[model samples]
Target: MANGIPLDGGRHAGTPTVGIVGLGLIGGSLARRLVARGIGVVAWNHRPHPYAEAERDGIRCAATLGELVDAGPDLIVLCNPLKAMPGVLVGLRPLLASRPRITLTDVGSVKGMVRQQVEAAGLGDRYVGAHPMAGNEHSGWQAADPALYDGALWALTVTPGTDYARFLAVARFVTEGVGNRIIALDDTTHDQAAALISHMPHVVATALVNTLVADPDRNIAAALAAGSWRDMTRVALTDPERTRAMVEEDSRNVAALLRAMAARLTGVADALDAYDDRALTAFFALGQPFREYKARERAAALAGAERQPEERTLAIPAEGWQETLLASARHGERLVCLAGDHTAVVTAAGMD
Candidate 1:
């Protein structure tokens, strides 16, 4: 479709209008990308100034949420914080019956709760849960960039009643538009996965920084700190309230992860206190391989993200299935057989 965001298999090509609620970093970035692609973007912010700011950036500013809702944009993206969405939904629900025919999605970090709120508010079919794995320690429009989504993994949560076709359309629109990877996950899976990869990591980073900062001998530690310490603690600068809110919202999962981590830390401490050189050496020995694997994984993810829209594709059957593989191959689809068990395997050629 428009904006060079690659479409999935059996997708149509066309530009679509989009409405964005909230003009913070995520919404502002989305507006810029959508506008760049010739897609109409009508946006609303509680603060009147963001509207003016967006106007200066070539985005249409709506005076009110009603104006934005009535615009009938093909999709409405909500970029408010998770805690803030319930109130936004309360405000938007009354207008649902009269709401424009459009796809609805949110950029909330947590999926389970937000999806529940949308469905509870009777906005089921129209709503999708979205999470962009991109952000900055600094927040607001000044940090907004259409390129912010570049090379990021944006998760789309698939819940019951979610329209699959429209969901795919939205996924393609975001991923292909601003260099990004789209990962589809169920609500529970999304939250747990994010807890391990994002939430827990942030907590650790912040804790590391806090521990250093609170030390009476902080100067000694800071003087001895190297790139590894700096890199590990960088995310500690992220807004505390936001992180705390996220931890509290998904407390169960976060707690479980944290407890497991704590148990491991306890083991390390016990080993150290007991002067167990064997245990200490065993623990330290694993760091090198873990670091190597992490580096490779990150590199691979970055490389996959560099794949262009021209490399976009979906798998189709290869030759000998029924006729020639010409139709599939012509569309850049490749196929392979899954003869192991009882399933069929088709590999897409263009995509990495």
Candidate 2:
């Protein structure tokens, strides 16, 4: 399809029947959102606990992985927890082998580890990695909402061996299927950025709350907590077990990031203790670029509907499309959608 330049702008064969392999918060929300958009979704969960509610939400509940595979989905999204990915992949291996037309993807927070697991399962060629920048502290089917994906940005990872047709399928699935934007990247880049922005910050949030809880004046602190405290510690309120699993999956990157964060924090503490003017000045100004970036974002959001983020088209080479997209993403351009099999429309609205 990449070479063929299909006139339909690289859309999947038909309105795809998406197979979802989990019924938890992210999975449930995706299934609900797809169903709401009039796309058929067949879903299977490790337990049938959410089947009834999912069915009412118009998601077809499958009793087994084989049943889900039999639905003839264009792609199967493995939304299961990282801990359960191996088992789920094992169950789908034989079924997917029979249905060679199917592509594979997952919504794991950490990309590098997931690729290893998928490759170990012998599904590497069929795989793509996806991580949605969408979630709140709460999780589970009970917290699932179709609106959770509102204006979400997704990171899609690829390798040299990734089939272009398969990649296009997943791209369309994100841009057109879910009405979201994507940034193409490789596993290492995705993992490192994720650690810096999300994984390390989560640990920092946990430590902030833990420090408060261990304080002698904990009750006073709780009573005095307001917007700043709430914002700082909000993510720590997530299920501890869930946060632990996510951090452990990307332990290497998270640990490295934690060390770097600790160094920065210790520098600030030293500056504060000694009241070193130079050090304190540098410390306070460390985040100026980020603050300016946020200011620009807020100004853009408040700007009139007449204006929008800058947009442009990219010519994707048939031979090295992956490299092209990766470079564009690294420079902070986001793929809005594919204009054709070899051309992509990207926006300049992104963090440097």
Candidate 3:
């Protein structure tokens, strides 16, 4: 039993039975992946079409929030819009009262406000906030893909009342089960990082599109648009309502980042106006090292993903060889010292 939760040994045992609260893109994609893995899914969607679609896809559709709770899910993932999540949480209280064992999580991008709402509703103990950095410009159930979460980074935020063991269970379910990398952080930290990485970039992309479309020379620019412009503005193709909700929900952090970006742009403009070659060169050169570092990080993560963990028992030469054996083990290895030998569990990718 994990934290008073029943540990029933069955086909569904050890694996979490998920009930998703929305059947939009993320929710639908998750349901598809989970169901494909033979995990039973009980999903709820306000829209009839998505519910029907989920049913067609072999997921059990819940008629109401109460019905979803009655389905007795080990975890409930709220995949509604950022603004709509608090109300969903409040509405689930009555149902949650009888089934306190149900763990709750969400896939909302901006976690600070959601964390506040979860705390205010007194569901923080059972709530483990999560944000999967995976999605496309498309929306709805039609865009759902089982591979949506593959190799993605899923951020989990823990509050003061959060159950660490429950959080770990959810994290493992997400990372190991769904093929994602789990990142643990506080809600505030998650929000700030998300703003800089996701929210601000989205705002900038939309603003760039807006600025260009308003210009008289936009037709000419569009005709000549190439890889650079297309790459930067690709996010502008996202669903407007979804983008608007994300920005408005995390407006403070997004605004702060926007202001910083504006300040930097102003610096670049000033250097250009003064024809300062050195300053212009310095400004353009600043991004090189950062981009290179990010590339290296991505390469490392991909390389690590190729490795698979294997348990191996090694006979050590001496009693005090624990440190040496562990030190000699390859990266991503877990070493344990046994009675007369050392057991090294290592992730072997291409190693002989």
Candidate 4:
């Protein structure tokens, strides 16, 4: 197989084409968005219905995994569940053996195990693990939306040995094409942080729903449930099989976080039982600042989305002029001096 094939147009012109395996929620949404942005997408799905739908929508649907590889994608995204990845990687090894320049990534929540598997398969340089921190409780291609990834944080796992050029290419596609913020983290750090923010919370939501459903007055309580209960347990409505697979893959980290949550809950129960007003007040107060901080973060993210800057390259006289321009630039403006003959780049910032 050829190492690189010019897709969409010339090798470096137009949008980069991507091959996506598993046309589920994330993959389907990605296809829609990329197609809308004029990027070519060749997709393969295990299910017959979604494959037909993709074909009907003008997306090149590969009849087999091998055919998808034959389509010559610059990037291949494995969108299957966490446990299914190792097998998928193994299967793709023979097809990808000669295509070292083709970058591969995934949308799996956990990263450490995936990174290990990629390295074991001798694809460490060709693969980067990505987890987009965006999704609904819904599953399958039917629920996929083109705007699903907008303004979301897409975490990319980068280790010391990671291919920086490949990583940057993927990062550019994710940010400029997908409209997501790129957060680069190590595999271990990504897994640990995902456990606390996503995996553990998912377990808690499911457990809460289980506890409520098992109660004698469950139906009545459910009928009376307000936004607090609904918001907290919304993730519990996600596909059970998918959730089980994800949690099982990262059980150790989730379990440890669950234990801490249990201990904290116990202390809260004790405070309530003893009617410790001061302790209750302190506990409640502690959460207020964090809640406010998160609100501010959301606002800032929205502002950033609205104020995306445009980059421009210009020929300058000397390096000193570029440095002077950088010093005089506003808060969000960024200037970089290139290595070539008096070339400088400026990213216009805070422009509406």
Candidate 5:
């Protein structure tokens, strides 16, 4: 599947050298993975001292962005803080002319802005936006793991400016080297979907846990803590600045989801007040399967040391002619909805 696409053009075949621009968890993990596979890695970090850590790990260290560029790596993986990309882009732009023709990707959680910057810089053909749906509470190189990407679902966002061939090459490289399955989408859709699933959930979990802790008898709730409470609030322990940037930058989408959740909660409270045992029971039952599905999905993604099969193409069709055509071209696929509109009559299919 590598298909003879040179990661670094000047290098001979079987050379798996990769350049990483940051020494954070994502960057360091990628470096470790390449080195473990017998691939050379040349990495750089803005903080000079981190180079010592990279040296200790036997990974090559570049003193400047130019040095990394000159090293002629096949791939340049960007792993800096999400908020720091714009500034880094400014500094890296001058080196673009001198840089080798290597495929580029970023591990930024949010893609819209990064996509925009890549396009603005006229490097769209070589750059792809990537988000590996995995991380830990800790940050920095100290938390790096070669297997961090195993079984994770990584979203590879291809904007209009991207080169399709390079996109496919990068996708295959990710699955083969990083051990992640690829989910493809355009930049806008990717960002919106992430805002709904990844960003909004974090805010909701943090808010729910904080609310419970605000009670004068908060310690009592802590004493009652179990796996469920801890599981639900695990994301609240992520890096605060990272979470804040995600929420604030995509405020519109996150806020919309939050409002919908508030409405659902209010409906549940109303049902309880009216002694509607049937409605409350229905709500509980509806949530049960969702919880079960989530547990199964999580287990599937992190089940073993081996990487999962790459997910090729998956689409959800809208109720329109346009969606029908798009689905057909995307493949002979049917969009199955598990849940209907909230106000619709409850049916078995909806529950399923």
Candidate 6:
């Protein structure tokens, strides 16, 4: 088994082709990584600036979205900004109507909203939702690097109505093509988890900077700032407009997470004010599980790349397949690849 996949896990006979909608950070990085791994990629960006560079990197640059479709990619990944999703979907609707075999998916941060827009465009049947857990505080093709996907994990969002073949296509694209791991989830579960882990924290990082700016002694604090501050506030360096758009698209989830986070902060403040040692201890203790989990991750990294603990084969059921994948993901199992239509090879739950 190469790249953690079984000999029978090859989902396609040859290197699969992909169509990219945007050439920004995430899309460009994926294109570069896939191409480096010998997968064929045809990409179209809203602007032609990235085309020259993308072509130089061996990615076929399409002059138009229609031209991208002409490449007959097995999967077309929508990497456009969330705001442009509706319009992009509108354009693709007519073009893709005759190409039902071409599975549609996106790298959108907010799956539920993207799925809604896809459904609104009457293309839901041809769509699956995907969000790769990769990226950085960068934008555009210039910032793109294939290394961005190193050890990346992706979430493939699905519903009961999603075609197993379509889901398999995207799964293979991630696992076999991109050489990444996959966790299956529904849109809501993905969105909520993303909000809790990513969106809310981005906002909190921004708030940290705002707090610094509001302080009259900010220059002094800045001079004394160290690694802890940098680690906590790094995401605040992301393009503000892009961050706002991401937070807004998943507004409900982000807002709810913000409320919960605020309560935690307030409790900490109250505890500190009262000098309650027990409350402070409890607050600190709450995170020990996560800390231990992260420690294990670091240990695993040192254990060598070839070591796959609790790796096991899963026989996918013909019925309740979606739930089967979702349940596995919920418990932190990652699908390495599909061995066959009714078979999945997975790694142990990460939290185990």
Off by over 4 Å in 1: 1-16, 275-278, 285-352
Report, for all candidates in order, the number of backbone clashes.
2, 0, 0, 0, 2, 0
Model 6 stretches with alpha carbons more than 4 Å out? 1-16
Residue 224 in candidate 5 has what lDDT? 93
Arrange candidates by TM-score, descending. 2, 6, 3, 4, 5, 1
Cα lDDT listed for each candidate: 0.69, 0.87, 0.74, 0.74, 0.69, 0.87
* Backbone clashes in model 3, listed as residue pairs: none
Off by over 4 Å in 2: 1-16
Instruction: Give the per-residue lDDT digits (tens) of candidate 1, residues 78-169.
Output: 98777778888888877667753567788888889888898888887887678888877777777788887765666777654555455645
Best by lDDT: 2
Clashing pairs in 1: 5-176, 5-177
Q: How many collisions between residues are there in candidate 2?
A: 0
User: Lowest-scoring 10 consecutive residues by lDDT in candidate 2?
Assistant: 1-10
- What tens digits encode model 5's per-residue C-alpha lDDT throughout 1-352? 3422334455653343577889888888888877776567888888877778677776889888888878777678888876777777777777876653677789887788887777677666688788888887778888999888775767777654456556655665665556455555666676777888888999988997889878898999989989999999999988878789879877888899899989989989999899889988888887687787667556756975474422222322333323332333234222221122111111111113
TM-score of 6: 0.94
Tell me which residue pairs clash in candidate 4: none
Better of 2 and 3 by TM-score: 2
lDDT string, candidate 3, 157-225, tens digits: 776555655665566567444655554567777788899989999999999899889999999989899
Candidate 2 CA-lDDT value: 0.87
Q: How accurate is candidate 3 locally (lDDT)?
A: 0.74
Report the lDDT tens digits of candidate 2 across residue range 1-352: 4322122444443333789999888999999998887777889999999999998888889999998998777779999989999898888888888777788999999999999999999999889899999999888899999899999999999988888888888998898878899998999999999988898889899999999999999999999999999999999999989888988988999999999889988998998899889999998898898898898888988995766889999998878888999999878799998888778899997567
Q: State, as a TM-score between 0 and 1, how close model 2 is to the true structure.
A: 0.95
For residue 174, model 4's alpha carbon misses the true position, in angstroms, by 0.6
